[model samples]
Target chain A: MKSAVIVFPGSNCDRDAQVALRQITGQEPAMVWHTESDLPKVDLVVLPGGFSYGDYLRCGAMASHSNVMKAVKDHAEQGGLLLGICNGFQILVESHLLPGAMLTNKKLKFISRNVHLKVENRDTPFSKSITGETIRIPIANHDGCYFADDATLDQLEQNGQVVFRYCDETGAVNDNANVNGSLRNIAGICNDRKNVLGMMPHPERAVDTYHGGTDGAELFKSMVEALA
Target chain B: MKARVHITLKNGVLDPQGKAVHNALKSLGFEGVDDVRQGKYIELQLEDSLPEDQAEEKVKQMCEKLLANTVIENFDIEIA
Candidate 1:
């Protein structure tokens, strides 16, 4: 499947995402810069992680309003698959593509570690490859904690939008299993049923044996295979 | 005219930074500090003679569209 990766001023993870996509899909995905309003014809749009716009004025705040985001938003509205990771997740939240907001970690420090994530909703485009299973993905970010009003959180839970929950190695949901201490120990979530996904974990960073293992590879495989 | 927009996390939203500041203030021996809510103050320079209401509306639009996430933040404007 064809894919496109969005690149913003401070997007450090764009290359990693491109490498992962190229490895999985056998073709290099187009790198669309944030300043340009054009988008190549593609099946999926991936918003890779980084300190976009230097993380000034809150993470992803500046990047969400970039010229390309309008196109990305339009593309997403057309039901094309969209996956946002790390700072990309922040951009999604800032752009209102997803509900809720990201806050500083409860401990008020940047955290980088391998985290266990339970696949809460496997029917989604991003998690369909893993069926009711737990996976290990690296999460690294400062403002990763997710915060929403009680009513909104309840609604999210009720709608089954909470796609990934933090879990222990044995796959048991528990507190602190999530690297960022998100409410409900949520590591990732999907919009409505599936099409769009936003998570703090770096699936691309974990997609190769050189990095660690290819456990995160299935996330991309799911998207590509599902699209086909 | 210049306007200052103060953006703060709304009530019921977890404020980890605010909590950290509160802890630091207490450790520094500040007394009677009931709470600490961290926020941002942004100053915007606008054309002179702009109507105050219009300027305020523009600032509000800025906050809602980009400056602040209304899901967890509220902003107020002060013009001078």
Candidate 2:
């Protein structure tokens, strides 16, 4: 499947997403800068992680209104696949592509480590190929706490929009395993349409064996299969 | 005209930084502190030609659009 990765000014993971996509899709994904008003026609659009706009005016607030976001919104509206990782997830929430907001991590510190995530809703296009119920991914950020009102959380749960949740190695979600204090241990969520996904963990970063294990490779493979 | 905006997290939203500050204050032996919440104060300069009412309105709009994240924050604007 063809894809394009959005590159904001401070995006440090654009190349990671590109590398993962190239490995999975067998072609280079276009790197679209935030200043550009349009996106290349592709099956999937990715907003990779980084402190866009230097995290000013809230984490993703400024980058949410960047020039290229108009097209990203358009792409989501067209039912095209869209994925946001880490700070990209922050931008999606700031953009209202997904519900909830990110706050400072509960401990008031940045968390950088490997965390186990249960595939809460694998029926979506992003996780359809994962043959297992859990995956290990790396999360690195200070403001990764997910927050939303009770009503919104309930709605998302009822609609099956929550795609991943922090869990133990045995796939048990418990309060202690909640890395960033996201409500209900949420690690990733998709919009009601299921085409847009915003996740805190960097699946791209986990796609290479050299980094660790290739547990994240299935997510990329899932998207390719769904898009195909 | 100059406008100042106070952006604060909304009620019921967890403020980890504020909690941390509160802990620090308590650690420093300030027992009288009831509760502490932290927020941001942003100042913007407006054109001199703009009327006071218009400037306040514009700043309010700015708060709604960008200065404040309405989902998690509340903003108060004052123009001078």
Candidate 3:
């Protein structure tokens, strides 16, 4: 499937996302800069993780207002696929493409490690190909804690928009398994339409067996198949 | 003209940074510190010729649109 990855100033993970997408799709995805007002025709738009704009003025706040975000919003409104990982997730929230906001980790420290994630909902394009119930992915961020007001959280739950939640190795969700103090242990969520996904885990970091496990590759494969 | 805006997390929202600072203060033997809440202070220089009311309105709009994320934070603006 055709894809594109948006690059902003201080986007350190853009190249890593590009390499992962190229390996999976067997074609180089377009690298759209933050200043561009338009994006090339593509099936999916991936926002990679990084401290965009140096994480100044809140994470993703500045990048959300970049010129390229207009096109990104349009793409999502049109129901084209969009996946935002880590800091990319923060951008989606800041852009209002998704609900809720990210807060500093409850422990007030940056967390970088491999954690277990439960596939809470598999109906969305981002997680449709998963054959297993849970997966292990690397999560690396300081402001990864997910938070939303009570009414919004209720709405997300009622709409089945929560796609992933932190869990133990055996796939049991508990407070101890929640590395970050995310509300309800949310690790990923989709927009109401299920076309846009935002998550804090770094799936690209685990897309290859050489990296450790190939669980992350399954997510990419699922998206490619769903588009096809 | 100049304006100063203070942006702070809304009440009931978790403030880990503020809590950490409160802990540090208690460790330093500061007494009667019932609570500690962190916020941002931003100063802006505006057109001097603009009327006071207009400048205040503009700064309010700026805070609503960009300076403060109303979803989790609230902002107060002061003009001088």
Angstrom error at residue A165, model 2: 0.3
Give each model a TM-score.
0.96, 0.98, 0.98
Question: Would you list the C-alpha lDDT of every candidate in the order shown?
Answer: 0.88, 0.93, 0.93
The residue ranges of model 1 lying beyond 4 angstroms of the native Cα positions read: none
True C-alpha contacts between chains kept, each model in order: 1.00, 0.94, 0.62
RMSD of each: 1.4, 0.9, 0.8
Least well predicted 10-residue stretch by lDDT in candidate 1 chain A: A172-181
Question: How do the residues A1-228 of candidate 1 rate in per-residue lDDT, one tens digit apiece?
Answer: 999999999999999999999999998899998888989988899999999999999899999889999889888889988999999999999998999889898788898888888888878888888643788888889999987777888988888899888799999887757667788887888888478899998999889999886778999998887987
**Model 3: residues >4 Å from true position, as ranges?**
none
| Docking quality category of candidate 3 according to DockQ thresholds | high
Q: Against the true chain A, what TM-score does chain A of candidate 2 give?
A: 0.99
Q: Taking the tens digit of each residue's C-alpha lDDT, what string does model 2 give over A10-117?
A: 999999999999998998999999999989899999999999989997899999999999999999999999999999999999999999899999998889999999
Question: Please, what are the lDDT tens digits per residue for candidate 3 over residues A1-228?
Answer: 899999999998899899999999999999999999999999999998999999999999999999999999999889899999999999999999999999999998889899999999999899999889999989999999999999999999999999999999999999999998999999999999999999999889988889898789888999999988
lDDT of 2 by residue, B1-80 (tens): 89999999999999888888999999999899877889999999899999999999999998888888888999999889
DockQ sort, best first: 2, 1, 3
